[model samples]
Target: MDSSSSVKIVSKHFVKPKTIAEESKQPYYLSPWDYAMLSVHYIQKGILFHKPIHYSIDAFLEKLRESLAITLVHFYPLAGRLSTIKTEIPKSFSVFVDCNNSPGARFIYATSDLCVEDIVNPTHVPLIVHSFFDHHRAVNHDGHTMSLLSVQVTELVDGIFIGVSMNHALGDGTSFWNFFNSFSVIFQAQEINKNDDLCLKNPPVLKRYIPEGYGPLFSLPYSHPDEFIRSYESPILKERIFSFSSETIRNLKAKVNQVCGTTSISSFQSLTAVIWRCITRARRLPLEQETSCRLAADNRLRMHPPLHRDYFGNCISALRTAAKAGELLENDIGFAAMKLHQVIAEQTSEKVSQMIDQWLKSPFIYHIDRLFEPMSVMMGSSPRFNKYGCEFGMGKAVTLRSGYAHKFDGKVSAYPGREGGGSIDMEVCLVPEFMDALESDEEFMSLVSF
Candidate 1:
């Protein structure tokens, strides 16, 4: 069967919170960090699970919808819509969440004839996977009219895929997973006791974090979203997951430390170093051309009066480390690893605050053209997130996959392996030519487990 054509939408609707008081309907201001992500696309990710033995699609949908409504009560901003306000004093516009007249979160139920293997066994991830997510290609700023959060449950022949697309302005990976974890917990709890009142172990802190003396609302530099937001079509790309066993990671870490004469190098840094080196070689860029790697650093713990772990918003900044192509390729893996380590180590609390303060002063929005520079690689997501731990009574997720949003050549996402114990699954996206060369590069594939 044609997988794309076989997939059909069963139902689609907005899922509102179970209970929200009128007094609590105040506007939730977007912070500088949140505003930085206004032009970026939604954070699209999905979890694939084996079909439960006694699974009934109808029953599962009912339970999922019910649990989501309860989850929305705590993550109320997600159920709200984005609103733009004009101020005459400075003649600027500010964006905030309108909690009073929320249209609720979008929920979709779909069905497909494909099986689990059709998704996982491919050498290159099929484009059909992108179909699983709603609000395809919509940027975060589109939340003004579109739903801020969308959930699509696609029932496969022998599996289930739960696709979640959250506006990047709403939260980061940490916040997104926190909401997913909470939703799963409530879903599982209801299975055991439907009448009991469920509670989140670590409920989200809704208050926006702003530096002292800064306005809670930051004015947009542009007069209209159209000034920054634009349609972007990436070059044809091939995505593949490169699995690194725990032992292989350990070896890489040891090699980097031994060569650099420093024991502080982490596994993630070491692994990313190898990826940088190999991809540079594959692209075969001019020796003098500059290349950089962008790492998404979480600022939750790096803040002055550190925000709560459950802070429900974007608290991430991209730390870029650049080197010439010749320098990166000619040096040992330890050199690249050390470069990453130093950049990450330098993001102290003061540094994070300074980054935010500078952004507030400039108020620049990220455009698609500015995001993907030449010879640049961006590493997003993290192996440390509890990707495999989100269980909604159908057992843990078999694997996690990302949708087409924010995908560009050299975009890499890291996830913990299904078997767990320190292993990592790197979901790598590169142009067709680069992907072909990287797959054949023995030096890089030597450590990758098939």
Candidate 2:
């Protein structure tokens, strides 16, 4: 069969909670951090199961649906929808989740002739992999209580691919992973015995109140979503995955240490520095132009009374550092690596508290649109997420992939390679012009296995 016609959607439906949760009627308030993600609707994650498994498609679907239903009971807020409310305290508009359980999470079952070997081992993943997902279910165009999570399971010739799209405002990457891991555990339990009353090992804490250290930041004035809600659109956008072996990473770290005359930096820091420097050079911006690297710093553990690892909300803050284009290009990788370390280190609990306190005092939420330009880069996701642990009775993921919407110029994502043992896969997006430069850059290509 031709690749385009190989995949077919068998069915689409919603997986409701097994039982109505007590908190189903309660409203879940959006935290200040959560509000920051209001402009972005959803995040898409995919995992490929390549190893042979014994279960049939029918059995696997039953396990996934049953487990997902139970998981939704614990993560009940995900079964809700987003709403704009008028608060009496400040007489202002606020964004809140109406846990009305109006519509359950969407689930799709699909079949494909595509082999896992063709998709999992490729350095440049084809964009068609996105077709396996019901991508439209994620965006709430009508702005009503709909599904906050959408999942698609595509059976391949050799394995299965599970694609998940979760509302960005509902939670961060940590929350998403927690839900997936919990769901996997339930699935595993079901696989062992047909009838099992499984409970989440780490049930989510869905309290709407922001912890005290986060300060008295209540609802701010709501603005027109169009201001910060613009989707990335470019005429010549392209995305490709670049693999870096453990040996390459070790060599890069050693080079960074040698340049800095110190061995304190981590592989993440070194690799990020190398990528940033190479990108800056590829852009070939003016010497005086400013270039910045933006990333998210998880603040769940940085707070005074640290939040539980299972805190089900956005417990992260944005971190940015900038240097002149000339300086970022001229400086060695270690210099950039040191700067990255310093910026991350500065996100201490005390510092985060002060930052939130300052934001609270402001009368309105500031909307800073990150323009996608050659001179700027924004990093998404991280290498530390437990991508390999999402085993749903079949086997651990052989490889991982992200959504196509991330294919905007200046956007990047990093994930653990399926090969494991400190390997990293970098998914990069750029305009054709800069992408050509990046591909031809000898130093960058030397480190990546293409």
Candidate 3:
């Protein structure tokens, strides 16, 4: 007999214990969301979909067991409280002993939204499950917990998807990427010390010293939350994807800059402008609609040793950009790229690093975050995740998608990985009609492969 490794092959989700520091970190309140990070070694969750990716009643749980030996961890009911105060990591992290004995993971089958999932959705915000599959993490940002990525087997037609729900209080995209990359290493018989350079060395950086007029923080005239939700109504969680040859994207970046008269814009900036343009027209808003949204810019470069490839765990900040929708598209792609570069630069550095720290340290943390929660959207990049290579040698993931529906109601995501060397895969979910129009457009299709 062999000892169970941190990684194992399984068909279900599992829960694990939080680390020493992880247990100690308390949830800090920020607006409607929290500021915190939990190293619940593995909150492995997955969905079982049938062939063709439809619901099926044939799925069952019986005598399903594996030697997971993972640390037992559960979500501490924030009861809606923040998750990054000064709580203990390993000890305060033990909310499982307090669990009402809820089974760790349950796989269900349902065809219609009305039939399958409605009955079994977790009634609580932080769901706790027990199992041995260590492949995912979920977090609650504001209105909903945002799941990063999903790991699942395909439904024969080469289609499979996983939905992760997580809280934004946890580290940032850098943090999530750290854990995910560690997961891959651990899964492949590699060593992973949380403090490893591949991960964060010290704890997460929480400094907040943002200048009053700093950042792309221009107040927009969007309607109230109630009014806003109704008009911008659609899926609260969205799954948008973009594809292109990795090489093609690099080339396009240069090409757009050449034509747009500025080298400030990169592939992401140019493509983002395209998405913004399409989105603006889709809503039939005035051509001058001042689109407001935020971007998660990596701050690894600002760290002393620089997070480098070593530092990890939420090492990023948010940047809110504002400009006329028409102007955004009306300008050369290069100009759009320049604005994006500037907006992104504002979010990085010790300034934002310290600002976030002070904000979290303040009593007005909750109040300040809530003020902006209703008026903004957050956009992230999947360009560097390299998810396609996660196949464990079976094969590249047939499809990699995010569980972000309305998280970015005005979300602008650009991930150009998939198709071998230079090809990119781009996706977006706006009004169904808007998506349909993009899908129907022959000119757009010429540039992108569905």
> What CA root-mean-square deviation does each model show from the true structure?
1.5, 3.1, 11.6
Q: lDDT per residue, candidate 2, 1-450, as tens digits?
A: 255646688998888888886768777777777766665547788888974656678877887998889888888888777777555555555677776736788889988878887786654566667776665423432235456788899988888899888887778888988888888877887778754466667888877537466522356554444433445443456678888998889898888888888888889888888888888888888988988887767888898878887888888776888889888877767778888878988889898888767666653332234433456777878888888889997677877877654456777888887677888988888877888899989889999975
Candidate 1 lDDT, 327-372, residue by residue in tens? 9989888879999999999999999988887887788777656876
**Whole-model lDDT for model 3 versus the true structure?**
0.38
For model 1, the superposed segments whose C-alpha errors exceed 4 Å read 1-5, 21-23, 87-90
Q: Which pairs of residues have clashing backbones in candidate 1? A: none
lDDT of 2: 0.75
Point out the higher-scoring one by TM-score: 1 or 2: 1
- Weakest 10 consecutive residues of candidate 2 by summed lDDT: 363-372
In terms of lDDT, the best-performing candidate is 1
Q: Per-residue error at 434 for model 1, in Å?
A: 0.2
* Model with the higher TM-score, candidate 2 or 3: 2
Taken over the whole model, the C-alpha lDDT of each candidate is 0.89, 0.75, 0.38
Each candidate structure's TM-score, on Cα atoms with residue i matched to residue i, is 0.97, 0.89, 0.58
Candidate 3 ranges beyond 4 A from true positions? 1-167, 190-240, 260-264, 308-312, 348-350, 357-378, 404-408, 420-422, 437-443
